[model samples]
Target: MPAKQRSFAQTLNAVAWSFIGLRRRRDFDEDVGALNPFYVIAGGVLGCALFIALLLGAVRLAVA
Candidate 1:
């Protein structure tokens, strides 16, 4: 049997781009360049949230 495929979020991050009509490769590059700050802020926020959740879970497990 073939291995299972990964989830969409694991394989690609094009959901937002698709909604904005940036489906083409050139359009994607242009959009990315124009939205560099948004991307940076999003990445930072996601990273921090994930880190905090992991830390809290670890502490809870240890205390329990």
Candidate 2:
């Protein structure tokens, strides 16, 4: 099977989905071949940062 072409948005979306723990086997398989490593790394880092920021904000809000 041919690899599916993925854009930067797609890579970012995939990384977000992964962080959210929602993924299908088919999509994972497609991403394996289509996603650029550099894009994935960048997306993952950005996603992690956003996630951390959100969590920190929530925690601060709860504590205050």
Q: Pick the candidate with the highest TM-score.
A: 2
Q: Evaluate all candidate structures by whole-model CA lDDT and list the values in order.
A: 0.55, 0.91
What does the lDDT come to for candidate 1?
Answer: 0.55
Give a tens-digit lDDT track for model 1, residues 1-64.
4334334342234434454456788755544534445554565566567768989999999999
lDDT of 2 by residue, 1-64 (tens): 7787789999999998988889888999878989999999999999989989999999999999
- In TM-score terms, candidate 1 sits at 0.46
Residue 5 Cα positional deviation in candidate 1, in Å, after optimal superposition:
28
Residue 5 C-alpha lDDT in model 2: 73
Regions more than 4 Å wrong, model 2: 1-4
What TM-score, over all chains together, does every model reach?
0.46, 0.86
Ten-residue stretch with the least lDDT total in model 1: 3-12
